[model samples]
Target: MMEDTPSPIDRHITGLTGKARPRICYLATPSGDLPAHLDKFHAAYGDLGCETSHLAFFRQPDARSILVSDFRARLLEQDAIFVGGGNTKSALAVWREWGLDTVLKEAWGSGVLLAGMSAGAMCWFEAGLTDSFWGSAYRPLDCLGLLPGGCAVHYSSDSKRRETLHAAQQTRSIPSSIAIDDFAAVMYVGTSINTVVSWRTGSTAYQTYCKGGTVIETALSAKQISV
Candidate 1:
């Protein structure tokens, strides 16, 4: 059921998909949250001689048993997974309700390559920038905590977004967070981290947390988000 779609995310993780080294793939969801961000993902894997297995719909494989069986198990077959950027809570809810959390964790911890962006990446951090939206309906929830404590996605300057980040700071307490400037990514390659730029990439911005004063912009290196 993989279809062609456009992409808003810079597809930063794609640059690292080792072509010669094949691996199993698990592309994350909210495929709808985003409109057309699948084509790039597919092409990345195509270069690697791998394909993205959809875990989004497997949550309900069949009211008629028409989509085959054991769909969740099939997601675990790949060597790597690509988690898409979407609403963190919504995305995690699907996986938790469908049991993909246990599935992916076991798979990744046991060596399933974890490749993700936005919500996918945010899932790894401790506190996510959930309040950067124009609405005030949802509160903070526990993310997957797969990465360092502070970081956010599509984090940048714009009238609406700036206000959102400010509010997120006041309410959510994301003392320090990251801004992925439209076309940049702070890639995590184990303890050794770096940045990957593409398109109209801007510098990766970091807002550090101080005790009571304004948040400090400690060091805005392109890739050094962590200390």
Candidate 2:
């Protein structure tokens, strides 16, 4: 349906999966496993010639007859896993309960493409700022640490996020890390960042770290992506 529109970002993700037709899973656990969140993922990537599935932890128990082990087995089949954005703290809590955290770590080691935005992105790093607790107040939390250091997504869109992350850096609460603007993503190969991509023309990425008791933010070049 969206064949007419070019998808540089999806293409980039697919490439990481190392498959011509990657089997992708949309995980909306961070969004409390919302149905609409999964629907949007299908709308975005369904026409991209990839096999797509959704993992609804909350609804699946009541909606289907399946074992958690069986679900874990299915996850191993995916070539790429795209986690959706929402409450990072809540999502991690549930993921730990179901052992998806270990499964994901295995997937990453086995070369499955792990990608997402905001909360999803933060989960891949050691730590990042999140507003999941206390409403809109951004606080630092230790995360999955798949990648080294921390991350701040929607960098330019949220003012508090920027301020809080900088403060974290200054106080050495978090290590040097990547901060990506809305519509921008940082691609990592293993633990190293490969490139920064943005869907919008003016979007950008930043490298933030503490230096001499001060926070240093260096602007990184961003490549524009289609669709």
Candidate 3:
């Protein structure tokens, strides 16, 4: 979620681009290209002196004006890509259909910093515990596989998330994973976690896996990035 003002996490992300004025592109596909969400993104990043832009799939005003090639070109030109949180299942389906998944992988390989929250964060991993099924219990959903292992978002706020993730690991439904609480994020360089950072005090991430026929949750040391 985006704050009313640029948060420390936001600054950290911008800094990762290693540009004085990074070209940041927001993808709101998970949220169905919600206008309000796009507004929030611009409001936050714009203030940070970022060259901000967003790609909207669901509500493209001039769909005819933007071709698939145009989308590809625009995305490749960005210094960073920020995905928004929403329905992971649906988002992946759309990305696959539009071949944006491949484009994203290429972008990452080219060193364009990829980041997001919740569903956005989950999309980068091999699989994730998702509530995208609506009425059904949280299930492990396959994701982009840009990063290895599984992911669990909203680990603290959503009580069922931790339970479902643990069960998935215990049953070998998904591999050893990381569970991230709100206001916290894990930074990965290649396939390994470089560090964990949190914008909220006491909010952190965890390494979850099944060991010796039991589920173990080990808290990852998080550096406070909050101002």
Candidate 4:
């Protein structure tokens, strides 16, 4: 777990209101660069009244554009910064120069709401088939430790990817882990996470990593299932 200082001005995600925190749109890919499978994210959140925007594939930071310019001010305008899922390696490569990852850490530390699907979520985890442009079919990358232990995005033991992740964990000797099922999202409030409304209209399975790992399929009902 990262030992970070308390954030300064917390971000106020636009739209919904509550001490319960604001809504964060987790796009399955970076803006303008989405995989064929997950393309409806833009309209999905926009229709729900979120001023959704894409930040991946951002050019050099400049106030006139989306990549740079005051990150703090831009963050203040939105309740949360939507993280677009894609190739973690590519994503990290794009921002590795500016240490954008560190910048994001600062934002998170300051209470900026961050929501992401697949890659977006996976990158934040401490480890687990990390940052692979070439489908990591059973191997791991030592990645940023946003969440505890290893985390598997798009988790499902039935699928090859899941099997690969499992194999990698054993092969690499990683620690306790959590895997999220497709069409499902795990929302975070500080260090805590609960199932938020999902997209797949399916079920997301949760798995344990430490001490004889186990997988649990968790189902949760919420006020808003789909917007």
Candidate 5:
């Protein structure tokens, strides 16, 4: 969501980079590199005292024109990469086709912080619940597997999210997953949860799974970050 004031989460992310002026990159692939999304990203991050740039897959002379080695080197130079929300399924297909999926893993392994909201966040997991299918109901879409198990975003804002995620688990369609409400984020360091934080009160994340044919939602402790 675009806000007149940057969210505290932005500050938190920047702080994680441990730099006074971090070099941050944006990936708007999921939104097909929509200009509006890119504009908003710059508007938000520009004032944060960091260098900001975006990689676009849908732009003219797109990723295909860039050599994989060069692309990897450019990404490795960044302190962090932030992905914007959009169609997860479509983004993944393009990323794989262009080998961005592997490059992202390399970036993370090299200590570049990986982050995003919605589709961006979901992509790092093994799978995520998505409504990207044009005419069908929400379903589980396999993801990059950078993080173990599955994920569900907008868990509180969208009522159907909880239902679909639980149902998927009940049927063994996805593994035990982390469900994050809007304005909340879960940080992972080396495949384990480092911390959970929320910019909005009452917004948090959950560890959701299926047991005995019933869905279980366990609230994760979240520290509220002041905006």
Candidate 6:
């Protein structure tokens, strides 16, 4: 977790759940559910007084290690689901096999705040610009569609991300999409943008779309936050 002075990241995420201290389930399937990644999540949210837990779907096919009757039951216990950034393609593959895709849809409808950057953020939308397929190039992949249109992350850090997303929008390969620079996030409250926030000052999100055969990139004003 990038530091937030007032910890607005924690506050906002927890706020979405209407809980002073949210129960957060960190899913690292996108990163193959790496132990280190899970450790990081535990360290970050745990520091903020969140009741933190995790779900791993790697070599353990049964998912029994999560200590729940079913994944759905485990998720229902959480007020928020945070996905770690990684190979979106592989994550979605395992999610479908485990029937987690539908489970997540149910979770979202029930008001479990969904969040993650990169693969985590992309999972909820209809499509996303990802490097998961080629590991280097941006490709638009159809996603869960919990949120409208498409999404992209690491806008400021990834060299090819902005141009690829812009071109995709111009070609109508994806819908009018939200592209978030590293350290910035767009909060979607039931398919509507609640706010654009960042852990770093001046980091921003963008609403990119096609306009008359050309791509338009509009910066979304953001509130700076840190913990």
User: Which candidate number maximizes TM-score?
Assistant: 3
The TM-scores of all predictions, comma-separated, are: 0.68, 0.91, 0.95, 0.68, 0.94, 0.91
Clashes of each: 10, 0, 0, 10, 0, 5
**Candidate 3: stretches off by over 4 Å:** 2-5, 62-69
lDDT of 3 by residue, 124-221 (tens): 99999999989669999999999999999989998888888888888999999999998899999999999999988889999988998799999999
* Candidate 2 lDDT over residue span 1-227, tens digit each: 11235557777787667777789888888888787666667767777778888777777643322346576777777888888889898889898888889999988998888998778999999997888895767888888889999888888987888899988888888889899887678989999989988877778889998889888899999888674
Model 6 segments beyond 4 Å from truth?
1-8, 59-65
Ranking by lDDT: 5, 3, 6, 2, 1, 4
lDDT per model vs. reference: 0.53, 0.81, 0.88, 0.52, 0.88, 0.82
Residue pairs with colliding backbones in model 1 are 6-36, 6-37, 7-36, 7-37, 24-78, 24-79, 24-80, 26-81, 124-146, 124-147
Clashes of 2: 0
Give candidate 4 misplaced runs (Cα > 4 Å): 1-42, 56-67, 196-202, 210-224
Residue-by-residue lDDT tens digits, candidate 4, 1-227? 00032111112223323434344433333333543322354445444455545443433322223434444455545556656655666666655664667766776787766656556676777775653646446456555577777777666634775666656555556655666765555666666665454434465546554334543233445223432
Which lDDT tens digits does candidate 5 get at residues 141-209? 999999999999999988888988898999999999999998899999999999999988899999998
Q: Compose the digit string of candidate 1's lDDT tens values, residues 4-88.
A: 3333222334434443445444444645423244545545555544544444453443222113246456655655677776667
Clash-forming residue pairs, model 3 = none
Clashing pairs in 5: none
Better of 3 and 4 by lDDT: 3
- Candidate 4 overall lDDT versus native: 0.52
Q: What is the alpha-carbon lDDT for the whole of candidate 2?
A: 0.81
lDDT of 6 by residue, 137-217 (tens): 799999999999899988888768988888888788999999888778898878899899887777899998888998888
Look at candidate 4 and give me any clashing residue pairs. Answer: 7-110, 12-79, 13-79, 14-79, 28-85, 29-85, 61-68, 176-210, 177-209, 183-200
